[model samples]
Target: MRISTSQFYETSSANYQRNFSNVVKTGQQASDNIRVRTAADDPVGAARLLQLQQQSNLIDQYDGNITNVRNSLGTSESTLNGITNILARVKELTISAGSGGYTDADRKADAQELTQLEEQLYSLMNSRDENGKYLFSGSRGDTPPYVRNADGTYTYQGDQSTLSLQVGDMLTMASNESGYSVFEQALNTSRSQTKLTSPLVDDGRVSLSNGQVSGSTQYNDRFRGGEPYTITFTSSTQFKITDAANNDVTLEATGEGKFDPSKPGGVTFRGVEMALDINLSDADKPNADALIAGHTFSLGSKPDEVSGSRSPGNTSSSQITGASISDSTAYNNAFPGGGAVIKFTSASAYEVYAQPMGPDARPVATGTLTGTPATKAKIAGVDFDFSAPPAAGDQFSVKVDNHQTQNILDTISEFRKALELPVDKDLASRQKYQGALQSAIGNLESGANKVAEAISSIGARGAALDVQADTNESLKMANTKTQSSIRDADPAEVLTRLSLQQTMLQASQLAFTKISSLSLFNRL
Candidate 1:
């Protein structure tokens, strides 16, 4: 297989050019320290790098969000701490004022102090976070949490929806709590009574009769009279009356006026014309006859009597036209006075009276009454009237939400009340309010703690990301080394190859020159 001169020259030139081109390409790649500078260089690795870079950027964004949430939580914690302090001061003032030794002026001073404290607490509850969001407001963080009215009541402005933060891919934690749960629902300070009054009265009496008498005649014929009478009571009070037989007769008041002689009225005496009268009075009064005279009495049946005799039963029933006397006799000894004694039926309904006591006067203090028909007496301000019935347990509760603005005002108002109340009776109330405040504090703390936990989780994730980033950087370096080994050229190796190629190209040119010179044309 003898190679032709033309063929050898052509093949050697091609081989030399190819080797030179390879050396240039490898040298450029080594200088750049990259195997795949573009997608055309290595499509798979370039795409993977792009995806990793995007993940890293997302991690950075998450870190920024976690930082913001952490700052908000910190602000909330600080504000709640301030509120806790104010509540503590209020408790102290309540204890001081409740001692009963404080004069009215002293109490007033205490009240003023409490008012200031309350205002401060309100401000704290309505405080804002670093992001200009209300700390106690649930989801409505931009609005104020409490509002105060001219009537001295507070309204809530926050909503019940909770605020939350995403700390991880699938983890979320609460960032805020509602004002209603912290304030209104947690603070309950009312009580009720147990016993109730019966709806019945006891003392009711009536009598009735009819007859005719001759005024200036020698004689008159006998006649008979028929009468019907009834006395209805206001309530079901129990009472007893003595009949002519000296037997005891018992009676009770019906809610309605239903007179049944077989049930309550006494039997009639025999063989005499008698005057009839009825009396209704309290069973405790000393004078009963003065209460009884000329009052009409209801009778069950008719009676026979002699005419022209002095029959004393015919009279009007509307008015008691007899002389009024404060006599204790002639009526049953149980009558006291012509008055009604009303009683309350339940204790819870009776708390309306007790509530006034907290605001009006201290248990043993001397203060002027503010209501009508006022009588001045050395009376305990805690006295209550049970003349009306109340419902069972006397429990009532109210809840308010969306109170971002009003929460502060309400807290201040309650704190002021706790401070101004009489020290003697307000100890329990103050303690109760303190408990409510503590619960609010706890809610704040819990929210803050959750934020803190999220922050911790974020920090952990950031640290892990940092480690991943470091590992990625190292892997990138290793990949560069592998690429260099696979496709890049070292300067020494490229120089050697270039020299060998130059030598071969020079040899090829010499051979081509000799071959052309030795051709047939040169022989001729």
Candidate 2:
């Protein structure tokens, strides 16, 4: 083939340029230790490398999240430990305050210490994390979990929303626990408060044991939210038991049997059981006969927190304040069907009706509200003070439920109050004090157990986080190895390719120079 001098020079220059470009590109690859500088170099491998890198980055982010969660768990665990210690101390002080040798003055001293411990416990319960978020506040991390009310009772404001953080692909774990689970759900003290209401009979003449709920299912079914049970001995040998509504319950609990009075056995009703004790001897046979004839004793369990709400249809400025279950028996009587609703017939007069109030609903009890700033009244078993005279037709519903869990802080506060009060040297006062102390101790122990469980849960989550972190690290290492194999240039191969390309470029340059000089243009 015939070729012009210009064509020959052009082909030789293009070949030389191509050889020079290869040498420079190989040298850059060796220096950078990268096999594919761009997608054009290795499209499939480059895409694979990108995916691995993204996965690695995601793994790092997940590891960071795990670390944050672990930190939060640690803070909570430490705070719970502090709470456990404070609860132990409070229980010790409560038991010591009940010592027979300790006088009222000693009890007051213990109360002072108890108050300080209570403050400390409150502080710990409202502990904040490193970032100033409340540790046990659940989803409301910025808000305080437990707040002291005006009446010295503590209320939990935080919700039960547990925060979770992702530690791996499609995997999440709880980072916090709600204060409700940790503090508000402690075991309820299972003792009844007994009152001898028969003015004619003295407590000394006939007394009963401190009652307890022996059967939970029975209690729940029959107690009717801690309705008070009244035992009335009709005669020396024959007695009758009645529920809150004045209905006889003798057949359901135990068969009617003659009591010798000298050998009085236990009486079980609803799910509660207590022994009747007669302090009168044979010499006091007349008193014993009188006690059996008309002596009446009422036993009732302390209800959980009482909640009252104004009816939405009511147009009134009046509010129910200091609402409480004053008498369990009456309270149960009030709710024979369901909840109790206080409907105002006039501004001063009101009537309580059984729940599911209808036009034909009958009032269970009727009373008139009259007093100063607050008018105190007892309906059924519920007691409440009215803030202002309600409008005619204004209604309020009161609900008293059976005790399931006791607030830890409230338990502490109640114990403190008991210690602070002055107890007279009387049988009644002594019995009251002992009952209050026993309830406080039971609650404190249960509260401590709850805190311990929370600590254990935190520990378990921390361990799980550790395992997840390790797994992430392993996954990251494996990804890195795959990324390296696809995207990294071998040191020896890059160096060898660079040297060969340089030699080839040099040979091309020398050959092009020799051939160009011998072209027809140079011959001319």
Candidate 3:
């Protein structure tokens, strides 16, 4: 092939320039210690490296999530520990109170200490996390979980929602406990003196103008002919009376010495009903009377006759003849059995009978009694009546339900007040309360243990995640190395190739210079 001298020189000069550029670029790349600076240099290596970098970033994110979960669990654990400690102290106080040697003053001091402990428990229940969120409030982390009432009751303000965190793929852990279960359920089932006894009359009777017993009086007859009458209830609620025909008669206050049958009354069976004729002139000591009215017996079917005389002057002048029965007959008719038996179906429930007495007259025989076909006794403003016979040697159980921890503490305080027996008797009573308190403490401890175990489980999972993250990071690094080997330029090899290119460029430049100098002569 015939080639021109000018063309040969031009091609050689271009080759020289290309070789020189290659030498410089390769040398610079080798100095930088990276084989591929851009995608264009090594497309496959660049894509693989980017994938590895993304994996590394994901590992970092996983690590951060694990950190957050650990922090949350730690805070929760601390708060739960505090609650456990308080419960332990309460258990100790309960044991001390049950020793039977402490005086009322001692009990009062213990109660005060318990009150403070309850307050501490309240504070613990409302503990916040590092992020200013309530730990025990469950998913409602923003609000306080426990609310204290004026009557020393506690109300659970938080919902039963649990907060969950994802620690791994398809693995989640609960980060919080429900305040409702921990506080509300705990408070409801864990104390003594939980129940109060209110006076109730079954088969109640009133005077009638007619011969047969009739409810045609101005005052409403709550009971039917055959159904038992419920005169009072011990709860903070009103009594419900179901007639033989299943009718409800509601009663409320009307005026002085009167009751409205359709309204709600404020008198609870266990609660004292005090009527105060408040004189604005005397602020220190107000005139107070027992708001509760005595049971009145009469001879007519009219309830208004209940407020009238018990018997007429003469049998001929009487509306109902032979209505004036003896107190023994009345007591027998009301109780059926002689009024000395007490029946109990459970610890807090019992039934007994109250002997007939004149208005405002205390019963001659008023003491604790228990047997079949229950008896009634008046003690400490409570009329304990037993419906069924209790187990041999069984006593009436008192249970108190309160809203707040402090309210439960106050209920204990009331129990201490109600127990006015000798030290041994009081000790026995205190033991009953102590047993209940111990049960409550056990429940709390069990809950706390469960929470702690759960937290530990979460911590283990978090630790596992940390290991996984580390492994993933290592995998990413190895993957990056593989990608570099496959497509990235090796520094040493690149530098050597660059040096060869530079040498080739130098030789091409010298040859081109000689060619340019003798083009015409060489062509000839």
Give one clash count per candidate, in the order shown.
50, 4, 31
Best by lDDT, which number?
2
Candidate 1, 1-524: lDDT as tens digits: 97787787787677657766655655565466445567766687667656655655555555555665556656665666666666666656656654646654676687798678767876877888766888766777777877664336655556566776554455454555556455434321111001111112312343322211111121111111211223222222322223334433322122222334324332222211212223345572344434432232332222111001110232211111111223324212322111111111232211212111222532222223222332111112112222222233322111212221123344446545544554445443434434333323333333334434434544554555445455545655665555555444456765666567666666766755666566567667
**Candidate 1 overall Cα lDDT vs. reference?**
0.42
RMSD of each: 27.6, 8.0, 24.3
lDDT of 2 by residue, 1-524 (tens): 98888898898889888988888888888888888768999999988888888899899899989988988888888888888888888888988887879888999999899889999999988999888989888888888887775457766667677999889997898888899899877867555656778855474766666665566678778775536778887777667777778877787665553466668576677776666665666777865566557777787875455766676578987778777777867665645433567888888788887654556888878998757743677766667887777889998866444566777888889888888778857666655676678678777888888998999999888888888888999999899889888888999998988888888888988888787677456657
Alpha-carbon local distance difference test for all models? 0.42, 0.77, 0.46
Which regions in candidate 1 have their CA more than 4 angstroms from the true location?
1-32, 175-412, 415-524
Order the candidates by TM-score, highest first: 2, 3, 1
* lDDT of model 1, residue 1: 96
- Number of clashing pairs, model 2? 4
Model 2, stretches more than 4 Å misplaced? Answer: 190-202, 209-278, 281-402, 521-524
TM-score of each: 0.42, 0.75, 0.51
Q: Which candidate model has the greater TM-score, 1 or 2?
A: 2
**Model 3 spans with C-alpha error above 4 angstroms:** 1-14, 162-488, 521-524
